[model samples]
Target: MRMTALSAVLALSVTAAAQSQPAAQALLDQGKWQEAASAGAALNTSAGLTLAAEATTAGASLVPDNQKKALFQKAQDYASAAIAKDRSNADAYFELARAQGRLAQFVGVFQSLGLAKDVKANLDKALELNPKMAGGYVALGLWNATLDSGGLKGAIAVQATGASRSNVAPNFEKAISLEPNTPIHRIEYANALLLQGKKAEAAAQLDKAVAMPAVTFWEKRDLEQAKATLAKLR
Candidate 1:
């Protein structure tokens, strides 16, 4: 009887943890980044770790510049922890790449160059783990695009990270194909198109992004950026 009771309690605990996932996701979707991170503290699952990493990185943008590095570091730590827990967790690798990318943005060109390898490696690993991970493809596309746009610095970045301009559009298109409803992919691809001097094509993509419905906090923020960029293009 005692063993049976213990098993029942264990099952209930598992169910409760599973139920909390939606609430955690809702917090993230609503842009309650700090809250989402806090909520994820109690969860030990891969989803929870990904949420914590994403929330930490997103929350960094809302904080003072001085606090940004610390938050990004936390995001990287959480993502690394997730990977340690589950090497096959594609989202964990994606979050690691994202956190590193954001951290690179705050540092100097030389520092960012060093981080480029890590960013590219994690993104690649994420895609290897899950071929259908659209976000990973988008990040990889951005990596290629950003490095190729740097001129002399871009050449150096290309040497350091081994990223190529040739891979950019194809990866973006793959991302769009994998997740057609995701507006951010369109916006990012549009940015890539503009980098390539394909103004008309970029404008079309931005228009499509503006018309798409944003279901999450990140998507809404991306939508606003897309609208602002579209205005500049027109």
Candidate 2:
């Protein structure tokens, strides 16, 4: 009787946790970053940790500059925790890479150089774990394009860090193929094209991105940026 009772309790707990996941994910999808993070914090699952990491990283942009690093650090910690729980959790690795990349933005160039390796490694691992992960491809594309734009500095950095510049277009193309409806992918690819002085090609991408419907807050922000860039190009 005691064993049966315990089993029932466990089943109920599992059901409740499973139900919370959708609610947390809904918060994330809606860009309720703080609420999503808080919801994720209440759970003790890999999904919860990954959601927390994503929410924290997304929320960092809304915080004061000085608070951004700490938020990203928290995001990194949550992602690491999720990885600790499940090594095959590709989303966790992606979130870690995203957090690290965001943190790099606030640091000096030398500090950013050091973090570039880590960001690439995590992104690579995420892709290795989940080859179909379109977001990972986008991140990798951005990495390649950013390094390629640095010219001599980029060349030295690539030589020193083993970051690839040759895969920029292919990576972005792959991401776009995987998630054709995602506006950010096109926007990012447009940015990369602009870096290479392909203004006409970039404008075409921006036009597509600007026309896409943005459901999430981040997507809306990307769409706005795309519009701004397109206006300038025109």
Candidate 3:
């Protein structure tokens, strides 16, 4: 399935949090959900966005997928608090988008679609406020590509249109340039390429994504599945 940008934002938040081994691990071990949650809540500006992202990510990591709504709601609360403190905070918007996206994913609720759109608007505003915001573009591109690709329907669309995987190449390409190391972008792009019967190209992208030092074990496992699926096509 084509994962949404919201999913990427949430995943990125968690991944950023995991990078700080000691702090995140300590909070997790202590069951300091509130503190951890608070720490994430604090990342609302250019100066502290990274920190905030990591904290929320740590909190999200502790919450199971089935219980993600509650966790995301907490994240949203934090994000809202940050926004209240700084109305023009781009990072705050990103975090809010992440939380909403997680909630959307948890329930597959159509109402969540509007929330995702809201996220895109925030991201768009973030870019207008700061054009150098590479993360914003990456997140936006992921959301667009996922929706456009349409999962199994996207595959069928590809076949029906006879457009080839090359047709959807731009979205993934843009995403990669914005965040070359994010595994999701490559995997999603590879999926598109595979649908177009561009097996070798897809494999190459997936291989590179899998090999990234930053890719988590589970992400690597997913890449492996993409590779395995591609191999079958070959």
Top candidate on TM-score is 1
Better of 1 and 3 by lDDT: 1
The digit string of per-residue lDDT tens for model 3 on 1-234 reads 357978988999877755544453355335565564444444333324333443565456556676666767766766677677777777777767667666666654356556666766776776666665555655665555444454675554334333233335564566577677777677766666654556788788878776765434345556667667656756
Give Cα distance to truth, residue 111, candidate 2, Å: 3.1
Assess each prediction's global lDDT (C-alpha) against the native: 0.89, 0.89, 0.60
Q: Model 3: what TM-score? A: 0.59
- Kindly indicate the candidate among 2 and 3 with the higher lDDT: 2
TM-score of every prediction relative to native: 0.94, 0.93, 0.59
- Please, what are the lDDT tens digits per residue for candidate 2 over residues 68-130? 999999999999999998899999999999999998888888888888889999999999999
- How far is 5's C-alpha from truth in model 1 (Å)? 1.4
lDDT of 1 by residue, 103-206 (tens): 99889988998788899988889999999999998999988988888578878888888888899989999999999988999999999888778889999999
Model 2, C-alpha of 20: deviation from truth (Å)? 1.2
What is the alpha-carbon lDDT of model 3 when measured against the actual structure?
Answer: 0.60
| CA RMSD of each candidate after superposition | 1.5, 1.6, 12.1
Clashing pairs in 1: none
Off by over 4 Å in 3: 1-36, 40-54, 57-62, 150-171, 178-185, 191-201, 215-234
Error of 1 at 11 (Å): 0.6
